[model samples]
Target: MQKEIKAIIDGWRNYFQGSSSVGLTLAQERAVICSTCEYAKYGKHAAILPDAQIGNIQGYYCGVCKCPLSTAVRSSGYECPKNKW
Candidate 1:
């Protein structure tokens, strides 16, 4: 719970500071890790409903920490609860 709050705060800080949270290469690397993780869920199982207006991005979600993979990977300060990334 504390970690989640910290991650959210850091994300907001990065946004307000106009800072790049994570590089594309690093984010991709993290994505790879997430793809093979047992705790990862995709499509509807990820609990991310499609938003037709936004092109219906099917994002991944973590079963453990319950954070969206897209947001988690992009947050430089975010550490995987299981220390996978």
Candidate 2:
């Protein structure tokens, strides 16, 4: 819960600073970790939207934290609920 708050704050800060994306390398590394995690879930329902997409893959969200990886990875203040990040 606390981590989510920090990420939200940091996201807004970055948005206003004209920096919406993180370093590509870091993002890729995080994505790779998420991709192979057991908690990674493909979002197929309207209520559960994907947080990121790779190629034609729809996207995935963390089953534990219920966060969209696409958005969470981009936040500098984000910490994985499972401490994977």
For TM-score, the strongest prediction is: 2
Per-residue error (Å), model 2, residue 29: 0.6
- Please give the range of 10 consecutive residues that has the lowest summed lDDT in model 1: 49-58
* Structural similarity to truth (TM-score) of each candidate: 0.64, 0.65
Instruction: Check candidate 2 and list the clashing pairs.
Output: none
Clashes of 2: 0
- Tens-digit lDDT track for model 1 on 1-85? 7866877676445434545367656766877888789988765533443322112123667788777666666577789889987
Expressed as tens digits, the lDDT of each residue in 2-81 for candidate 2 is 87788867744543454545764576677788878898887753245332333222367779877666655667888777
Q: What is the lDDT of residue 73 in candidate 2?
A: 61
What's the CA RMSD for each of the models? 5.2, 4.4
The superposed Cα distance between candidate 2 and the true structure at residue 35, in angstroms, equals 0.4
Error of 1 at 71 (Å): 0.4
